[model samples]
Target: MTATRRAAILIGVFFLLTEIGAIAARLLYAPVLTIPGYVLGSGRDPLVYTGVLFEVLLVIAVVGTAVAAYPVLARHNRAVALAYVTARILEAAIITLGTLSLLTVLMLRQQPHAEPGALETVADALLALQDGTLLFGPGLALGIGSILLASLMYTSRLVPRGIAVLGLAGGAVITLSTVAVIFGLYGQFSAIGLVVALPVFVWEISLALWLIFKGFNTAALERMPRRSVDAAGAEVAS
Candidate 1:
């Protein structure tokens, strides 16, 4: 297979990994996120550790999607492509921070505490940090990055226009919904949140499957190596 074809497959695989890792990590983190005083409770440590593993993998996958897709995107619009990568990095950094907070929660349980209820207080604060990161990382950064990448795809005609449209709508919806959540319109993961986020989820899955099976509209990218795309009013010989 050609290098571009292989890159498309790699991007698809990373997208699928991001999906699986996200779901697995969230479910595995239930005890810490939901149960009361999980830092004080015993058992289920293994599950939490497994969740950490999933999240670590998720962070890798999150960045992989942007990196794998960057070359082709840069050919079309270097500035937007760079912006997408930045957004993905921001998302991954926020997720790492959230994961670290959870790890700190677990660590707090092991260490001895002098003040009464201090463990619970600190654990609760860490848990809150985790949630806040989720709101900004997956909710905000993901949305912005999706829009940037999808807009490149849409304007460049590198993929089916219909798929690109879905991505555009999905990104806008999720970003707006996240803003509402930020204003206390609803809880993150509430019914409203799920409804607003569904378009983006579907968009990602569709894009992943398309890349894996059909690949990009290679006709448009036949000269991809030259970085001579005429989209977005940008042109370059680099």
Candidate 2:
């Protein structure tokens, strides 16, 4: 297989890994999410640790997707590709900070005679940080990066135009929804927010599966300017 195709598949794999981590964390953290005191309770150590593990995996996956896709995207537009990579890196960093907060909560819980009120306050703050990261990292950064990358794909025909359109639209909707939530129009995880985010979720997963199973469209690749590809590669390397 071509190197570019392999990279595409790796991106899909990493994307899938990221989703898995998110799902697993949600399931494991369900009981603890709302109950600030739950972090100190008995028999929850494994759950907390496992959830943190998944979150670490998430960090890895987020960065991996961007790094893997950089070359292919750079082939079409070097500046946009670099921006995408930067966005993804920022996303990963924000999420990593969130993960560290969770770990801090865990450490606090381990201390003997820890103050319940202090634990609760710290936990609440950390959760708020996580929520903010979701809004800033995935909601804003991911949306913007997806739009740029999807546009490149559409213009270059790297993927089907339909998928590209879905991505562009989904990204815009999510970004807008994020703004509404920030303005207090609704909660972050509210029904309206989920509805708007559904498209981007679908677009990413569909794009992932397509890349894994079908790879890029060679016809489209041929149609792209050779000069553009070479220039982008040089830019990335530099």
lDDT of predicted model 2: 0.81
Give the TM-score comparing model 2 with the true structure, all chains together.
Answer: 0.90
What is the number of backbone collisions in each predicted candidate, taken in the order shown? Answer: 0, 0
Global lDDT of each candidate:
0.89, 0.81
- For TM-score, the strongest prediction is 1
Over 4 Å off, model 2 = 42-44, 225-238
- Displacement of residue 151 (Cα, Å) in model 1 is 0.4
42 in model 2: Cα distance from truth in Å?
4.5
lDDT of 2 by residue, 130-194 (tens): 78987887788778877877888788888899999999998898889889999999999989988
Candidate 2 displacement at residue 123 in angstroms: 2.0
Off by over 4 Å in 1: 113-116, 223-225, 228-238
Q: Which candidate wins on lDDT? A: 1
